[model samples]
Target: MPALRIEGYVIVSADGRLADADNVMPDELKFEGDKRFFTAALDRADLIVHGRNSQEDQPNAPKRNRMILTRKVGATAPDPDNPKAILWNPSGASFEAACAEAGVRSGTVAIIGGPRVFDMFMDRYDTFWLSQAPRVHLPDGEACFPGVPARSPQEILAAHGLKPGQPQLLDPADGVSVTPWRRVA
Candidate 1:
């Protein structure tokens, strides 16, 4: 089997929330610098994995190969709406199988997510890029990862054997910064 370099990408509020109470990403969480970084990362990935609620809205999205995680499908099924996408159920199919079904042999796999989806890959990510919007706070919102709000995203990552690199300021004006948490070999 070809080894996949799995990477996760997410931006969260200072409180570690990824979305609002209704599972909506607020406008305040969207920063130009983060978006640029996200776009560039996804553009370099051979396969993009995400939950149904998470999607890339770039002009190149339609052409990018994607695997949408969902229980609606028994295993790997071709997405009728998008020729470049596959509906995958991890319970019924392995990640490698899903990648093959998506026609990706071996390359970087970018996992963009909602909380549940992000939780599923806790042990698999080689690097997780976590961006923070320092001034934003969502007390009742969805967490970036499973134990969030209760445990900070940083704490969760550290517990999972991922160490944070020096953070880069993505947008100083908005107090937005990103840290790459890499798995300790």
Candidate 2:
């Protein structure tokens, strides 16, 4: 069995924040460059994992095998149009066993976020494809990866054995930016 690889792709402020006060991501955050990066990453995945909020946010939930971790499993239903999602409660043993059974074989296993879900599996993840945008201040909203006190992206990367791999400064004309990180060792 190949090692399971957990990858995350999120856009953040230059200062390293994920969202604004209303938990709404900035329009500039989702650049075409990032979308291209995400689509390529998804293409190499055998399974995709996401929180309920992420699933709702996705315009076209993928048709590839998906596993959703949620507290309210029974209360919600998977999108009828998306045939690949499998709902699983985010508890202890059940969650682990379900993930194992998902058959995340030789390809990537992506973990799209909702903060809590990312925190739960952060230490276990192998790589983080984060997009750091130019500095932008926000008054409120949820963050990209939660739990740690606000810190510079460099500090966060240092803690996780991650290093910047690719920096695609979105069209200089557009003023957007994104960086990819690979886990070192």
Candidate 3:
């Protein structure tokens, strides 16, 4: 089997929230720079993976190789509405099998997230892009890593042996920054 690189991408608020209290991403929280960054990042990936919620949230997401992690059984086929995406039941099918089903040969696989999805790939990521809006605070919102009890994203990544790189400003006016973390060899 060819080596397949795995990476992660996420955006969180100052209060560590990934979405609003209703489990939806607010339009105001969307930063154009971040979108551009991720769009370009995915361009280099052979496949993109996300949970069902992420798939449903992006109704118009551009056609690209993708895997939608779902618990629904017998969904081992490509999504009819999205030619580039396949509905995968990880419990029923292995990730490698899903990649083969998606036609991904060998290249980076970007993992976009909901907390559940994020936690699932915590130990497998080689690189993770952590973007944040330090000035934005969502008091009643969903955390980046919902179920796993963690103090902060940085601490969590560090504990996983990921070394943080220099931070880049995604949007200067909005206090949005993105930091890349690479796992220690």
Compute the lDDT of residue 50 as modeled in candidate 2. Answer: 75
Model 1 misplaced regions, further than 4 Å: none
Model 2, 110-175: lDDT tens digits are: 877767776666666677776656645553656666543376655665577777776777646555
Encode model 1's per-residue lDDT on 110-152: one tens digit a residue.
9999888888888889999999999999999999998888899
lDDT of 3 by residue, 24-86 (tens): 887667898988888788777888899877742343356568898877757478687778788
Against the correct fold, how does model 2 do in TM-score?
0.79
* Sliding window of 10 residues with minimal summed lDDT for model 2: 54-63
User: Where is the poorest 10-residue window by lDDT in model 1?
Assistant: 114-123
CA lDDT of 42 in candidate 1? 94
RMSD to the true structure for each prediction, in A, is 0.8, 3.3, 2.1
Ranking by TM-score: 1, 3, 2
In model 2, the Cα lDDT at residue 13 comes to 68
- Segments of candidate 3 deviating more than 4 angstroms: 55-60, 147-150
